[model samples]
Target: MRMVWKTMRLRHVGMAFFWACSMLTFRSSILLTGEANTPELESIVVIVSFVANMTTLLALAAWAENDPERIDRLPLWPMAAVVVVGLVLVHFAGRVGGGALLPFLLGGAVLTGVGYGAFWGSWADCYGRMHPARTSFYVPVAFLLTAALFLAVSLLAENLSVPAIVLMVPLPVISLVCLVHCRAEVPDGRAVPEGGSKRSLLAVGSLIGLIVASLVLSCLFGFMWELTVFTVGSVNEAHLAPLVANLMVAVALVGLVLYARTRVNLDIAYRIVVPVIVVLFAVLPFFWETNPVALNIIMSASYGVFDVVIWSLVAATSYDFAVSGFVVGGIVRSLSVLLRLIGIGIGFLVTLVPGKPSALIVGVSLGALYVLVMLGLFNWLRHKRKAGAEKLEEGAQTDAFAQLDTSAPDEISETPGEEDAAPAAGAKSTDNTMPAASAKPTASAERADLDDEQALYTTIAEDYGLTRREAEVLPFLARGRSAKVIAEALFVSESTIRTHTRRILEKTDLHSKQQLIDLIENYE
Candidate 1:
């Protein structure tokens, strides 16, 4: 548990700061939230920003694929500087010309989106190179820190808007500095995976599934965003919503870490949350007017949990598939933002319904929830079928072994000399000159040696505190199996095997696979 915290570094803080700033762009903030007479003006500016963000992601992905060398050389500092300038312009334009300065506001929004896309895409690349164990520990802490930063900025918005804006202006630059350090920390030896066709089909499928799940959750949250108010009790308490929602996210992530420890089976988490989330949406319409604050908290907290899960899965998939992190991040996150925009539109339409608008919102929310639930069920069924097939295969092997043992005695007498020579094969020497008791010890000794070997591996795994998946990968690694071979044997992706191998090495404080095998060999 303590080792998990030791993995935290400046990279986590960088992630938090950039995310806080990006989120601020979408919300009601003094600096970026411009004054517009009509909702159309605000929506148009938001839509443009989102579209620009998606465009930047796809562009970065294409660039990474065509010329991988240029990713490291991208001009991030200039982009960050431009983002700050755009925000400042938006602020000034809103104050001076009010609704008349639509062009400047739209321009600023586009620049902000472009900058955000670059930063987030690059950050995903960094995470893709890292081990999942370290990532699992860092993500929750980053979310917690982002929440704190957001809370502080929100409080400052009411009384000291200038200082708040000033504080936020340098966040993008500081975040980039931290990111540079993170890149430096990665070893040159970790090779960038080559060619998209070589990537695992399972890994690709998992990536698509994760993206769809995220989009569904994001869309639902956006729908809820239209109907709910941010206030807790009074209007002033609205500012505290981000803080509260983030705290809940932190709690859920921490609990998930504790629940799975090393394995972090996200499928189980998905199954557990689906029904609870469905029930929450079902009851939301009833409380839409009675207690808006509670609805806000529930929706925000649920969405925040999914947010971390999706981010972590995206990072893991890039590493697993050996694809460019920028490519994976850009494709998945851009689509997520686009879907959320669509959801907002759907919610807006529901709001405009003549009478019983609450009933319409309820129907739409339920429909979305149904899609999400069906996806979970499909994944669960696939997993169960795979497991059953593996079990049947094991049973067949065991039966074959049993048949061989029963027939061994009859074949033993025909070649007594050969049988006696191969003592470790558990064969009985049916020689008339030898006692039956002498043959029994040879078989028992072979069993003892096998037991001893297994015990040694288990002891070493315990001593190093390896996660369940890491422990499973260790014996295969010690036996000199390639990652691809192990992945086939275990019914997982090669990238997944590599991740588990890396985690095992990290936990054992060893530098290479040979060192791990040597340790096991030398163990008493």
Candidate 2:
């Protein structure tokens, strides 16, 4: 029992360590730029790294689409980690070689960027898959915890006699260990999926909007966290770095924890709190001139809110799609990498702004307004979709009753001729009466979609005469259970579960899990 518990916990611990290390590395951007005075070095490193990271992340998304394998076996993670090690080696080589740091800096940036792309992709894949139901809160919570830990370490190491390398050790070491373990346990690599109907077009659109909005917001956040907050005034950057990092992370954590205990209305929060945040941004110039601490507090609080809200959006959309862990993970992580790159570039540019209040205010206000506009678009799509679903449900109930009453030849009964077989010349109808299988579903079929997923699974499978193994797999499929999850529950290989799913689909004449879940709704 103890061993099992430890095994379950190892991945979480390893992820915590990796994310904390990542937070530290992000903070180090200021330190790196501060030390390396050459302008050319900064530009070269940022541009090259940004391109490399984006390419690698896109590649992961593409590869994940093709082969939904587990993180450790994906080859991407191992290669990225190796490049990171090379980055470290280059950093030292530069120290010893003592010449133009441009090549080394660019090399380090590319390597580091590639590494981060893989690292985040894997983390997103694991966490998103394991906790699909709770990922909205979990992803942000994970970030909050890691940020806090990163801050604590920075503070302690500032005064302690520990070597610098110790700070960097956890990211690479713990992450590798976790990936290896994940590989061994889930060798098949597909995520256990949560079952559901196909998402509405509006729901999908909202998600795409979210991805775009988040990328923009992340860029602004990157600018602020990296350099803007620290440079607000003539204060101690080193001391302030850890303090602000802790503040942002702590406040975000506390806020999220509190929100978790309540029914956090996304629309309500956005309507109220976001305006206040916009107000703060409007007045950032004044705060920068007066109390940097106060400005930092406001910024930190906004970041905290951003952490919860953005992650929640991702989680909610993933639920809508009923996506596999690998697919969603790849999507989410790839966006994160791109956004971070944007943020870093934006933040770096913000640092170059002349020490004038007007320019700062303009930049900040523009960013806030842009975010607000994007958010409005996102909410509009979400609410519209939700309204459409509610309407569809009402229509479904109405149609069910109408179908039960009319007894059209198409709306066949559970036992078609059992009751109404009095001297009628007609061909026998199947127990389940879906229109002969086609790509385009009928209007009546659309009205039969259901929300009670488990019931749907049983109804469809029994009506179609599924084998017992297929019967066992059916409920999980109706629930949109991933191949990995179904495999584990049945104590079988993922390949076996996949085979069962294929047969079930074939026998039922259902094209996909989403269709199966929808199939039963047309009746009850």
Indicate which candidate wins on lDDT. 1
As a TM-score, model 2 comes out at 0.65
RMSD in angstroms, candidate 2?
Answer: 9.8
Over 453-483, each residue of candidate 1 has an lDDT whose tens digit, in order, gives 7777766654564544565677899899999
Q: Which candidate wins on TM-score?
A: 1
Error of 1 at 441 (Å): 16
Clashing pairs in 1: none
**Model 1 segments more than 4 A misplaced:** 33-42, 65-70, 73-75, 98-100, 189-192, 195-201, 207-210, 229-242, 255-263, 395-421, 424-524
Q: What is the per-residue lDDT of model 2 for residues 403-522, given as tens digits with 9 covering 90 to 100?
A: 654564344334456334522324254333322222124444555654455455544543453434566677787678899999899877899899878776786677888887776456
Residue 63, model 2, lDDT? 59
Against the unseen true structure, what C-alpha lDDT does each candidate score? 0.67, 0.54
What lDDT is obtained when candidate 2 is compared to the true structure?
Answer: 0.54
Error of 2 at 447 (Å): 11
* Root mean square deviation (Cα) for candidate 1: 6.5
